[model samples]
Target chain A: MFLNETQEEVRNTTRNFVNAVIRPAAEALDREERFPSEIYEEMGKLGLFGIAVPEDLGGPGFDTLTYAVVMEELSRGYASIADQCGLVELISTLLVRHGTPEQQKMLPDVMSMKRKVAYCITEPEAGTDVSGIRTTAVKDGDGWVLNGGKIWIHNAPVADTGFVLARTDKEAGNRGMSIFIVDLHAKGVERGPKEHKMGQRASQVGALGFSEVRLGPNALLGEMNRGFHMMMSVLDKGRVGIAALAVGIGQAGLEAAVDYAGTRKQFGKQISEFQGVQWLLADMAKDIEAARLLVYSAAMKIDRGLDATRSCSMAKCFAGDMAVARTADAVQVFGGSGYIRGFEVERLYRDAKITQIYEGTNQIQRMIIARELLRKGATS
Target chain B: MKILVPVKRVVDYNVRVRVRPDGSGVDLNHVKMSMNPFDEIALEEAVRLREKGIATEIVAVSIGVPQAKDTLRTALAMGADRAILVKSGDDVSQDLEPLSVARILAKVVATEKPELVIAGKQAIDNDMNATGQMLAALLGWGQGTFASAVRIDEGSALVTREIDGGLQTIRLKLPAVVTTDLRLNEPRYVALPAIMKAKKKPLEELALADLGVDTRPHLTVVSATEPRQRQAGVKIQSVDELLSKLKNEAGVI
Candidate 1:
C-alpha cells in the first residue's frame, strides 16, 4: 500500500522470479551448502544486483526504496540470496560515490556477477569495534604492502576481488584506515576453508589472509584514511537492506504458518479455526506489516536526502527482533512438523537469527538509536 | 510483419471473487487486478515471433479503465514495441461486453492495419470467448481459435488448434485473428532493466468515443451469486460401513 506503481511493478516481478526460481531451490541450496551460481547468474541478468548504481554504469539506477523492496522479495525466497544482493549494493555504492572512473570500470562486471566481490571489514579482533582492527597497509613507494587476516568474510572463498579495510597510519586511529581493492588471486593471498553455519548455509563464508600482498598504485579507493567514514556513510542503507531482509523472513514464515494452519486439521477441524492458532497467525501478520512499514519509511527517508540514521537503526533492530520472535511462532503453529529439517519454518527461524547479528547487531542498533536520540534530542 | 496483441486486465486469478450482495456483479472493491493469463500467453507468442525475426513490430492494445495502462506497461516490458489504451470506462466493476470490444478492435484494425491479430481465447472474468471470432467476422478474415501453436509462412499462417478430442491444423490468410489457448506459450518474466526501459516506450491513449464504437452493454446481468460451498463429508470406518453409507445416505451404490 505504501509503494508507488513502479515500486509495485518491481515487487511483482521480483516476487515472481523469487517464487519460481529461488524459493524452490532454497531447500536444496541449504541442504547442499553450495553456492547457486545459476541463480545468481539469472539474477544478474535481471538487474537484481547493484540496484542503486546508475544506468550509465550498467545498473538499473533505482533508488533506496526500490532496493529495499527488491531485498525483501529476494529474502522472502532465500535470505542468502538477499545477503548477496546487499553485499553488492554496499560495494557498488562505495564505487559510485568514491572510486575513480578507471576503478569504476568494473561496475558492469560487478553488477553482472562476472566479478564476485567481498567486503572485508570484520576481523578476528574487530567485530563490532572498528578501532580494534589490526590489518595494516604500509605505504611503500607508489604502492602499499598489505598484511592482515579477516574472519567471517562473506564470499571470501570464491570472490575474485576484495575491498580490504586496513590501517594506513598507526597513530591516526579511525582516520588511519584506508580501503584498497585487492585481487584475491594475487600472490601471498590465502583463502581459508568455508565455514559451516546454522543458516544461510548457501553463502560461502571464510577467512582471508593477506601476507605482505603487493598492491599497485591504483589499489587505493577514494581519499586515503577516509575508509571508516566512507563505510559509515553506507551503513544506513545497509541497515535498511538487512531490515528488509528480516521482514522478508518474517513474511515467509507468516505465509507458511497461515497456509499450514488452514490445511492441517486438529480435533476434526482446521487449526486456523482455533483461537490459539489464530492469535499466533494474527500476531505474525501485524508485526510483519509493522516491520515492513518501518523498512519502507527508512528507505524513503534515505531516498529523500534526510538524516536516516535513527530510522534505519530502529528498522533494523525492531525487524530483526520481530523476525526471530514471529518465526518462532510460525514454528509453534507447525507443531512437530515445524521442527523437522525440511520444513521451511525451521530454516526460516534459523535464517532469522543472522539478521539480528549481522549488519550491526540488534544491540549495536539500539546503541546507535540511543546515541542519535541523545545527540539530536529524542523529539527531533 | 506487424502483429497486434489484444490484452485485458482482469481480476487476478488467485483472488477468491465474491458476488455483490445486491446481485449486481462481483465485488471489485480493493481487489487485485492483473493481466489475464491467456492474454499474457497471447502476448508471449507475439514476442516469440518478434524474437524469431518473423514480426517487425508488436502493438499491445487494451480496453479498460486507466489502470489497464499498468498491464500495457507489463506488455511492453515483455517485449511489445508499443501500446494503445482505449479508455472504455472509469468504473473498475463494469466490463465491456465482447461484442463492443470486438467492434472497437475492428476500428483499431482499420487504422493500425496489422498483418496479424492475436488475442486471448477468453477473459477469465466473463468467459466470453467471442472477441476474436467476432473481430474476424467483422473484418471478413479467416480466424483460428484455441491455437496451441502458430507459425507464419510467406503469406498464410499455420495454426494448431486444440479441438474437443484432438488437435486440428488450420491455415489462415494474413490479417487473420488467432486466439491463444493454455498450451500456446509461457510468458517470460519482466526483467527490472526491461521495465525501466519500457517506461520510455510509446504508450498512446485514446478515449472510447474516439474509436466511434458503441460500448453500451448489449446484455444485462440479471443476478450474480457465489458458488455454494461443498458440505463436509463423513469418514467411513470399514468397508461394510462405507457400502452401507453409500447405499443408504449417498444412494450412489
Candidate 2:
C-alpha cells in the first residue's frame, strides 16, 4: 500500500505498457494458445525481470512489494505474461540466494531476458511431496550424469537454461537432492510437446526428460544436499508471486464485472442497479482487497528478512480461492454473453483455476498454514 | 546537433477530470499526474533523432512544481541525456501560460545553446497550442508546428506539418522550433532498468527567479464547469413531426 516513488513509477510504466501492448494482444494470445515472445522481449527491455533482483546483479533492485505490484498490474492484463515474469524471478532469486559465483553469473542474462530459465522441481511423481522425486544426478568422473523427468514445467519448451532438482543421494530423502543449472540445449535433454492448458495458455508448459545428461561439477547450484532447503526458500517467494498474480486476475474479473453490470440491462434497468448484482460486486471487491493485503504483507515480510512461510501460504490459498470465485462471478455478470469464447471474463474464468493448483495446491497451502500454526502457535 | 525538448506534467489523460466545487480549478488532489501525452510525443521525436545519429545530445526541460521532476525523470528514462526542472512552487494559481513557459525556456536555450528545440504542439490539460510558436518567436527562429514527420540534414530540418488542408512540409534552419503532432513516431516504452538509470542521470532544478523571468497569469479563468449532459433522443413517428421539431424546438431547419 505504501509504494515508494520508484515503485509507483514502475507501476505506471508497466501499466502503460500493459495498456498499449499486452491488453490488445491478450485475447488473441489466449485464443491461439501462443506465447507472446515480442511482448516478453519488450518487458525484458523494460527491466520487469529485474524488479526484485539486486542492482549489482544487473537488476533494477526493487523491493518485493514493487515486484508484487508489477506482477499484479501485468497479471491484470494477462496472467500468462505475469507468470512468465514470475518464473524468471523465481530462477533469478534462487540463483542470487543459493547459486555459486559461476551459477550466479547467469543473472544478467536472465534479467535481460537474453536467456530464459525454468524451475524444474515439480515432477510427475512429485508435486506436493517433492521428496518423492525420482530424478537422479549420479557422480561420474568429476561430472554428474542426470537421468530423470520433470512435468508441468513452465517455460520448459522455450527455456535456454533450467534449474533442475535431482537426487544426489537417493537414501537421504529430501536432503539427497541438488539443483543443477542445465543447458537445456545440451545432449540427452529432450522436451515433450507443450501441454494444451485450459487457460493462461500464453505460457508454454511441458515435460522435460534428461537421459544421462552430463553436467560439470560447476553446474551444481547453491550447495549439494541443500537443494530442498533452497527450493523451500524459493517457494516462499513463489507463493507470494502467485498470490499477487491471483489478485491481478481477481482485480481484472472485478473490473470486468463492474463494467458489464453497469452497461448490460436486464428488465429495463442496469444489472448494477440490482441489489443481487450489487452484493456480488461488493463481495468481490472486499475479497480482492483482503487478499491483496495478505499478499503484500507476506511480500513485505520477505523483503524485511522476516519469516513469511505461514503468511505466504495464507495469502496464496485465500487469493487463489478468491480469484476462482471472483472470475466465476464475473462470467455470471456477463450472463450468456460471458459463456462465449471471445469474452475476456470467460477466459479469465478459465485461467483462475490454475492459481489454486500451481506453486503447491491450495490444499497444500492450507496444510502448510495449519502445520505452521500448530508448530509456532498463533500470534494474538 | 544538440536538441532541447520541453515537457509538461499534466493530469494523466485516462483520468476523468472533475472541476472543483468551489470553481478554483480542476480537482487535482490525489489525482494521478503524468507527462503530457503530446510532450511524450515530442520527447519521443527528440530521442529518435538522437538514435538516428542526427542529434548528439538531448536536454529535456520541464516547468512546474517540484513533482515535475518525476516527469523529467520519465523523459530521461525515455532517453533524454539530462534534465532541468524549473520549479514553479506549489501555488496552482500561477498562470504558467505558454508565453511565460516560452520565456523561461528561452533563457534555458541561451544557456544550453541547443541547435534545435522540439516541443509538443500543446499540453493536453490546457490544449493552448502556443508554446512552440511563442518559444520560436522569443528565440527569433523559424517554427514548424504540428510536425508529423521530421528529418534533419545539413544544418536544417525538414518537417511535415498536419494542417487543415493537408500535410505541409517545411524546412527550418538549424536552431529552430518543431512541435510534435500525434503522428510523429510512437514513443517507446521506458523500461524499468532505464528508469533506475534515469535516477542517476543529471536532473538540475531551478526556480523561476533563477531564470530571471516574470511568472504571472495573463488570463483569468471564470467558473470552471462540466459540460451539459445531452438527453437521450426519441424516435420520430413521421416526417411531418420531425420537420416540426426541427423547425420549432431544435431551430436547425
Candidate 3:
C-alpha cells in the first residue's frame, strides 16, 4: 500500500517473472544445489541487479524502497536467486560510489552477471567482529600485495571478481582496514571446495584464499585506510535487503500453509476450519505483515536520508526472528508432511534459518539497537 | 503500419469477486485492479508485431474512469509507443456498454487513422464479447475474432481463428480488427528498466465529450447473483456400484 506507481509496476513485473520462471524452478535448484546461470542471464536482461545504481551507470537507478520490494518478491520465489541479486547490488553500489572511472567500467559486466562478483568480508576470525580480520594488503612499490582469506563467502566457487577487504595498518584499529578490487582468477588466489548448506544451497559458498596477490594502483577503492567505514556505510542497505528476504521466505511459507490447510482434511472437514489452525494462520499473517512494514519503513528512512541505523537494526532483528518463528508455525500447520523433504514449507523452514544468522546475527542487531537507544534518548 | 490496442481495467484475475448484497453489481470497494487478461494478450500481440517490423508504432487507448490510466500505463510499459485515456465516467462502478465503448473507439480510430486495431475478445469482468465486432461494424471493416494466430503478409492479415469444432483461417484487408484469444501468445514481463523509461513516454488524456461521441448506456445490469456452490462427490464402493448409479440415477449410460 505504501508503494508508488513505478514501485508497484516494478513489483508486478518482478512478481510475474518470479511466478513464471523462478518459483517453478526453485525446487529443482534446491535439489540440485547448482548455480542457475541461465536464470541470472535472463534477470540481467531484465535489469534486476544493481537496482539503486544511477541510470547513467547502467542500472535501473531505483530508490531503496524499490530495491527492498524487488528483494522481497525475488526471495519469495527463491532466496538463493534474491541473494545473488543482493550480492550484485552491493558490489555495484560500491563501484558506483568509490571506484575510479576506469574501475567503474566493470559495472555493466557485473550487473549483467557476465562477471560474477563476491563481497569478501567474512573470515574465520571475523564473523561478527570485523576488527579481528587477519587479511592484510601491504604496499609493494606502486601496487599492494593482498594476503588474506575469506570464509563462507557467497559465490566463491564461480565468481569472476571479488571486492576484498584487507587491513592496510595493524595499529590503527578500525581505521587500518582498506578495500581492494581483486581478480579472483589471478595467481595466488585459491578457492576452497563448495560447502554444503542448510538452505539457499543454490548459492555456491566457500572460502577464498589470497597469498601475495599483486594489485594494480587503481585497485584501491575510495580512500586509504577507510574500508571499514565504507563497508559500514553500506551495511544498512544490506540489512534491509536481508530483512526483505526473510519476509519473502515467511510470505512463501504462509502461502503454502494456507493452501495446504484448505485442501487437507481432518475429521471430515478442512483443516483450516479448526480454530487452532486459524490462529496459526492469523499469527503468521500478522507477523509477516508487521515485518514487511518495518522493512519498508526502514528502506524509506534510508531513501529519505534519515538516521536509519536503529531502524535498520530493528527491521533486521524483528524480520529475522519473525521469519524463523512464522515459518515454524507454517510447518506446524502442515503437520507430519511438513517434515518431509520436497514440500515447499519444509524448504522454506530451512531457508528461514540462515536469515537469523547471516547479515550480522540477530544478537548483533539487538546490540546495535540497544547501543543506538542508549546513545540517544529512548524516544529518539 | 500503426496498431491501436484498446485495453480495459478489470478486477484482477487473482481476486475472488463477490456480488454485492444490493445486487447492482460485483463489489468494487477496495478491490484489486489490473489490466484484463485477454487485453494483456492483445497488447502482447501488438508489441510482437511492432518488434517484427510489421508495425511502426503501437498506440494503447482505454475508455473508463480516470483510474484506468494505470491500465494504459501498463500498456505503455508493455511496449506501446503512446497512450490515450478517454474518461467516460467518474464512478468506478459505472461500466460503459459495448456500443458506447465502440463509439468512443470509432472516434479515436477516425482521428488516429491507424492501419489496424487489436483488442481482447472479451473483458473478464462483464464478458460482453461484442465491442470488437461492434467497432468493426461501425468502421465498415472486416474483423477476425478469437484469433489464435495472426500473420501479416503484403497487404492483408492472415488470421487463424479458433472455432467450436476446428480452426478457421481468414484473410482481412488493411485497417482490419483482430481480437485475441487465450492461445495467441503470453505477454512478456515488463523489464524494470523499461517501466522507468515508460514514465517519459507520451500519454494524452481526453474527456469523452472531446470526441463528441454519445455514450448513453444501451443496457443496464439487472440483479446480479453468485453461482451456487458445487456439491461434494460421493465415493463408491465398487465399479459395479458406480455403473449402476450412472445408469439408474444419472441416466447417461
Candidate 4:
C-alpha cells in the first residue's frame, strides 16, 4: 500500500499470476517431492532471470528497488521458485559487474530469458564461512584448472551453466579464492543427486564436483584471488534480495493467518476475535512492516552506490528472524491444522528457517553489524 | 532505417497506487517514477533490430518535463544511439494519447524521417492504451498493439501480438508504429559506461509551441475523490457458520 501506482499494478499482476499459476501447484510439488523446473522455466519466459541484468545484456533496465519488488512477488508465489529466481539474479549481477568484455558478450543468453544459471558457492562444509570453502581453481597455461566441489547449490542438476567459487591460493585467506563460469558440459564436471531438503523442497539443491575442470582465461570472474571479495560484495546485494524473499514469505504466512483467524473456531468464538490470537496477528503485521522497511532501505542504498554492507546485514538478520518467528506464529494461529503437511503456514514455517541460515547466518550478520559499528566508532 | 521510439515517464510498475485527494487524478508528488514499461518494450524491440545489424540508427525521443531526459537516457543505456526531448512541463494532466504526443513527435518524425516507430501500449498511470494507435493514425502509419514478439526482415517486419484470448501475427510495412507488452522482450539495463555515454548522447530539446502544437487537455477533471471504504467482514465462529454466511448472507455459494 505504501508503493506507487505502477508498483501496485506490478504487485497485483504478480500476485494474480501467483494465485492462478503457483498456488494450485504448490501442494502437489511438495507432495510429489518434485523440483519446480517448469515453474522456473515459466518465470524465465517472463524475463525473470534478468531482473538485475543491465540493458546491454538484454535486461529490462530496472533499478535495485525494482528487483526487490520482483523478488517479493516471486517469493510470495512459491519459495523455491523465487529462490531459483534469486540464483539467476546473483549470477547475472556478478557477471555484469566483473565478467570480461568477451564474457559480457555472452550475457544475452542469460538476459534474453533463454538460459538457466546456478550459483555454486555453498558446499556442505562452507554454508556460512565462505573462506572455508574447499573448491579449488588453479591456473594452467592461459586457461585455468578447477578441481574442487560444491554442494547445496541451486539448480545444479538442471543448470546449463553456473557461477562457481573455487580456491586459487591455499595460503591467501580470502584473497586466494576465485569465481569461475563453469559450463555444465565441461570436462571433469559432474552433478550429484538432487538434495532432499525440508523446505523449499521443490528447489533443485545438489552437489557439483570438479576433477580438473578445464576453463579458458575468460572463465575467471573478477581478478585472481579476488573471488572471495567479489562473492562477499555480491552477497551483500543478495542479502537485500533474501530479505525481500523473507518478507514475502512472512506476508504469505500473515495472509494465511488472517484468513484462518476469521473463520477458524475456538470454543464457539472466532480465533481472530480472541485477544491472544489478535495480538499475534498484530505482532506479525508489525514485524513484516519493519523487515520490509529494512530491506527497502538497503535496496535504496545499493541503488545509490553507497556502502550498504551494514544495512544489508541488518536487513537479512532482522528479516530472517522475522520470517521464522512470524511463520511459526502463523502455524500457531492455525492451531492443529497448521501441523499438517499441506497447509501453507506449515510450509512457510519450514521455508522460513533457511532464510536465517543462508546468505550469511543471522549470527554472522550480527558479527558483521558489530564489526561495522566498532569500525565506525573507531573512525569517528 | 532511422527509427524513433518515444518513451514516457511513469511510476515504477511494481509500486502500489493511491488516488489523490480532490479525485482529479493519481497523486504523483514524491512518487518514484520510471520509464513507462511499454516504452521499455518499444525501446528493446528497436534496439534489438540495431543489434541484429538491420538498423541504421536508433534514436529515442520523449515529450515531457525537462527531467524526462532521465527516461530517454534509459533508452540510450539500452543502446539507442541518441535522444531528443520536447519540453512538456511537469504538471501533466493532458490527453496522453498519440494524437497530442504525435503532434510533437510528427515534427521529429518529419525531420528525421525514420522508417519505424515503437512505444509501449500505454502508461500504467492512466491506462489509456491509446498513444501508439493514435500516433499511427495521426501520422498515417500502420500500428500493431500488444506486441509479444517482433522480427525484422528487409524493408518490412513481422510482429506477433498477444491478444485478449490468443495470439495473432501481422506483417506490417516499414515506417509503422508498434506498441509493446510484457512478453515482447526483456529490456536490458544500460551499463556504467553506457550510462556515461548516454549523458553525452545528443538529447536535443524543443519547446511545445516550437512544434506548433497546442498542448491542451481535451478532457477536464470534473472532480477528485477517494474510493469507497467498506466495513471489515465480521469473523465467523465455525466452519458451519462460514458455510451459512457464504450460502445465505454473502450468497457466494
Interface RMSD of each: 0.8, 1.0, 0.8, 10.0
- For model 2, the local distance difference test gives 0.90
lDDT of 4 by residue, A164-269 (tens): 8888899998888888888888889899998888888887788889998889878888888898888877787789989999999999999899999998887988
B16-117: candidate 1 lDDT, tens digit per residue: 899998999999999988999999999999989988999999999999899999999999988899999999889998888988999999999999999999
lDDT of 3 by residue, A1-380 (tens): 79999999899889989999999999899999999999999999999998988989888899999999999999999999999999999888888999999999999999899999999999999999999999999999999999989999999999999999999999999999999999999999999999999999899999999999999998999999999999999999999999999999999999999999999999999999999999999999999999999999999999999999999998999999999999999999999999998888889999999999998999999999999999996995
lDDT score at residue A217, model 4, on the 0-100 scale:
76
Clashes of each: 0, 2, 0, 24
TM-score to true structure, per model: 0.95, 0.93, 0.97, 0.64
* lDDT per residue as tens, model 4, B161-195: 89878999999988788888898887654433354
- lDDT, residue A164, candidate 4: 88
Candidate lDDT (C-alpha), each: 0.94, 0.90, 0.94, 0.80
RMSD of each: 2.3, 2.9, 1.6, 8.3
After superposition, which runs of candidate 1 have C-alpha atoms over 4 Å from their true positions? B230-253
lDDT of each residue in A1-380, candidate 2, tens digit only: 47877787889999999888887899999999897878877787788885778778888888888889999999999999999989888888888887777878878888777898889998888988999999999999988999999998999889999899999997898789999999999999999999999999889999999998999979998889889989987788889999999999999989889988998988999989999999899999999999999998999999999999999999999999999999998888889998999899999999999999999999999999999999999981
Once fitted onto the true fold, the runs of candidate 3 whose alpha carbons sit more than 4 angstroms away are B236-249
Clashes (candidate 1): 0
Query: Model 3 over residues B54-84: C-alpha lDDT tens digits?
Result: 9999999999899998888899989999999
Docking class of 1: medium
Q: Which ten residues in a row are the worst by lDDT in model 2 chain A?
A: A1-10
Per-residue error for B121 in candidate 4, Å, reads: 18
Tens digits of per-residue lDDT for model 1, A1-380: 78888888899899989999999999999999989899999999899999989888878789999999999999999999999999999999999999999999999899889999999999988999988899999989899999989999999999999999999989999998999999999998999999999999999999999999999999999999999999999999999999999999999999999999999999999999999999999999999999999999999999999999999999999999999999999999999999999999999999999999998999999999999999999895
DockQ of each: 0.72, 0.68, 0.81, 0.05
